[model samples]
Target: MNDMDKTRLRINRSLILQEVRIEHVRDFLYQEGIISEEDMDRCGNVTKTPRERIACLLDLLPRRGPEAYKAFCSGLQETYPWVVEKLNSTPIPETQTKTLSSTVLPNKEMNTGETSERQRIREPYTELNHTVIKIVTRSEALNKYKDVVRALGVPQPDIDQIEYANFRDLQEQFYQCLLKWQSREGRNATVVRLIEVLREEDYNSVADKLDGYID
Candidate 1:
């Protein structure tokens, strides 16, 4: 890849991590033979989280022969139109911050501290209550609820109780766990905090994605 192409990917890394449905992109690349089966498997399983998986794939792509960049852009079109748009547009100057602030904030200058504070204030970008419950429950359908709840620091006894209460339905078990956490945390249960805990547990993909759910 050329310097500009590499720069483009770097600039859009967070947006890709946040907005793109990675599974779809992976499949598209695999079908086109841009990435081999082994490459796909490693990206899916060897990586601990979605964030890691995306990073892994991005790392692999730049070396997958000359067609890699073109194939990646094509794949993005299927599930990440905005990413495609950004990639096609002018690259952000390398001297700029290259964070999502460029996309959310207007074209203007600000000191680093002010930018960080305002961005923090805008964080989590999503409503906490029922929306979080829905997001976790829906996203974790194929994952083990017990592990997720444990990672979230739910007490083992509470986890056991929830398992017993919803033994037949994993989604319900996860749903109940989030509800319990929300109840206990009360106003402190912000999406930002939830994301922080998830990242601490190495659920970086989930944490990275939380902000993209703004709607």
Candidate 2:
């Protein structure tokens, strides 16, 4: 396929993936009465009963062709068995950080002369507990992002490297960094920095194209 055709297919795949994730959330919400039976019914056939429809939607079968959806769901189940479990289970309590203080003396030999030793703040967890929550909460959006990534069929080590909780944070940081980098040094610097931060070839490619017009 031509480049434009390929781009469109990637976009479509992303949209499909996002829809599937949103459907899963919708199913969970419906089960909890967060959404009404009427809204649930509006989602339409993927199953014989309303309850079954929840499963069908989460499985992404109603929209995808049966065979493909089945295979995809199976593969996803294998890859992320905990996804449903986590979604269904109660969310964990948010962790809190504790600040500890240490005695410090100012001396040329003891404290490097002037600056006081900073107290180390211990994190409650090795990583943020909310990372998974954010991932689950934003699954629909991330799934859309994943679709584009999947279409490229190229490894996205950087995207994989980010902690799930940090996805939104990282994106925000990158945007701010891009604005600063672009303003100071122009398009080339901004594109390079964006690629470094995003670590996705597709995003880098797009950033390169948009570089000139960025302020």
Candidate 3:
């Protein structure tokens, strides 16, 4: 089997799906015109867990053709706008620390004389320095990284094979693409962080490596 075939594997796919809420998906599909009200009634039954319902829908939708499949992904993006937003956005450079001028603080919190929660938090801000950060969401991380590929200028067709892929398969592809594009002209903090992720390293360790990049 070829590399793309390997990415289509269903192994461990449910690990991600098990965490999703099916109604959110059904609502999105319906809203996007991917499924009809009648279709929802038939497929949205509570008898199945959210994952199971989605599994069933996953099987059924593709039978309707590629256009329907694209609609499903679009609906999924709507169902979880946060995931899509994270992937779509560009990562800002790290290592610069400047205080929020209290302008950014909510008016009530401004006078509290604190850094204002995360506006002062150390850990999350530090990790942002690593351009090769792992996504917090487990199920969507591969696609989130796939979004990085979109930014990287050229995505091989294997990327498309995972458009509607289940989690584990996409996870495999995520690393594969990252490996192909990895810069070889000596490693920097960002590249190191990417290496850590490719090695399945934990985020905190990766974050610390990233912090070292701070200027």
Candidate 4:
């Protein structure tokens, strides 16, 4: 199959997964009597709706499914307005941290009215250093990396087709794209611009490269 076909198939698979998730939620809500059978059917068929029309609606209404669901639960809010408000108000929780402590004993006591030697020596700032170095984890980094990869139309191989060298090369190219994106201020550029860069970098040939890497 051609690259575009392969890409579309991957996308369709992802969409199917999303649809199944949505359907599960829909069925649960319906069974609970939160949504009528009619509404459930309408929401379930969302994938059949034209994406272009949905995109236009998103431009005008500015909402997502979860946001809409939350707004529906809010009772006081109008559907579209609540959806927009909830979407805008969605919160990303801060990362969690762990603290460690070490204790040191004094070798000698200080002179009169002075502190002990151990008291004089400041404790190493483990918490402070942890705070300073605190950043997104590898999994979070990879998640964000994959988002840009998908947006750029970079090819993704099935698990069985992935190989070490090809994965490394793809990662290197992704980092390069990230750096370029950062340097460009990552603003005002269209999705098409990012896709163009990926194409130029031959990231579109990822499947073939994976085969070569395995060989």
Candidate 5:
């Protein structure tokens, strides 16, 4: 795949809308000079909701420049390592060029507070990150994510959006639900808590499976 296709393929649009703090993404991209101040304002002001802003941002990235894709990944890696992980996992075709030309942008250091905020967002992912991945993958197969999420009290609108986004693929729908929960809960999205929710949803077998990872 070429850069543009690779860019679109790597970014899980629905997951981004659900999980990413778009403000941080915007700031990072702006600092990298991938997006201009006017672009930033349009992304924020043209869209009312967080989801809309992220969607708008994603739409803007491909058209920004060739380096936009790489810069986007760099910014995401700082605050959303899992997102970068997912993006990197996308398979590139053998025909694709191995060497991508890098364009050096102007140096604009992120301020102390912006740096701190990225650090804060990254901390929660350090623990239980792998476990959450395993659980989401395994739970998707079990097809019980809907029950678990509903029992965990995901808002109806979020649930509706999840259904709408991945209508044809049940597994993807489940994955989206877990991401929604994780994004919404942040540090509170613990493996123990997920297990509890599963059991409460009467999926003890699933809960037991997840419990094994804790030990």
Candidate 6:
């Protein structure tokens, strides 16, 4: 096969491997009388590389036609819709950095410290959102930001913690953090609300994605 064909096949097999454990596929083949236990043991060895395991499964499929393999893949799609959706989504490239500070942050000269801090905040645009204003109260998007505060020595917030305030004030506090890391200006004097935003974040980088921030 050509290089493009080989890449596509590798991607396909990787996605397949995510949801179809070797044992399940082997058991199906064995129960179907398509492969003997000995054949499975030889071909479906767990120690083998992923490509090899997938190739072994392919060998077990009907050699006479592609229909059997197609049916098997179709069954996987029917059974695991989420896996199928993940497979269909485009894979993120390691080299790409999805930044939004240009569009999200207003155009104005920033101090050296703010610029340096902003430079550290790298992320994939798809996963990172700047919706502090629009996000619903129930949304867990800011969970990590809350965790950051807790790590900095704030106690764990009590469950169902009620801090009654006007909805507009809440939005303003959130915006202050998104625009500036602090939230003092966003609240009424009698009703100070605390909010947090992070910069210099892996919440922007692949490493940040793999290990997460605060690692």
Top candidate (TM-score) = 1
What is the lDDT, from 0 to 100, of the residue 28 in candidate 4?
Answer: 44
Tens-digit lDDT string for candidate 5 (43-78): 888437888888788876654434566777788887
Model 1 stretches with alpha carbons more than 4 Å out: 92-215
Question: What is the descending TM-score order?
Answer: 1, 5, 3, 6, 4, 2
TM-scores, all models, native as reference: 0.41, 0.18, 0.31, 0.20, 0.40, 0.28
Cα RMSD for candidates in order: 14.7, 19.3, 15.8, 19.5, 18.8, 19.8
| Residue range with the least summed lDDT across 10 consecutive positions in model 2 | 95-104
Write candidate 4's Cα lDDT for 1-215 as tens digits.
12222233233333333322343244444443234344445555655554432332222111121122332234323323433354335443232111111111122233343564443443222111222112211223333344333333222331113323346554444454444333444342333343343343344543232222223
C-alpha lDDT of all candidate models, in order: 0.66, 0.34, 0.44, 0.33, 0.63, 0.38
Better of 1 and 3 by TM-score: 1
Question: Model 3, range 25-70, lDDT digits (tens) per residue?
Answer: 6776555545555557766887867777767665545333224534
Please identify model 3 stretches exceeding 4 Å from their true place.
1-12, 78-215
**Ranking under lDDT, best-scoring first?**
1, 5, 3, 6, 2, 4
Return the clash pairs for model 5, or none.
none
Candidate 6 versus the native: TM-score?
0.28
Give model 1 RMSD, 1 decimal. Answer: 14.7
Q: Highest lDDT among the candidates is held by which one? A: 1
Off by over 4 Å in 5: 1-11, 92-215
Worst 10 residues of 3 by lDDT: 1-10
How far does residue 19 in candidate 5 sit from its true spot (Å)? Answer: 1.2
Worst 10 residues of 5 by lDDT: 101-110
Residue 18 C-alpha lDDT in model 5: 82
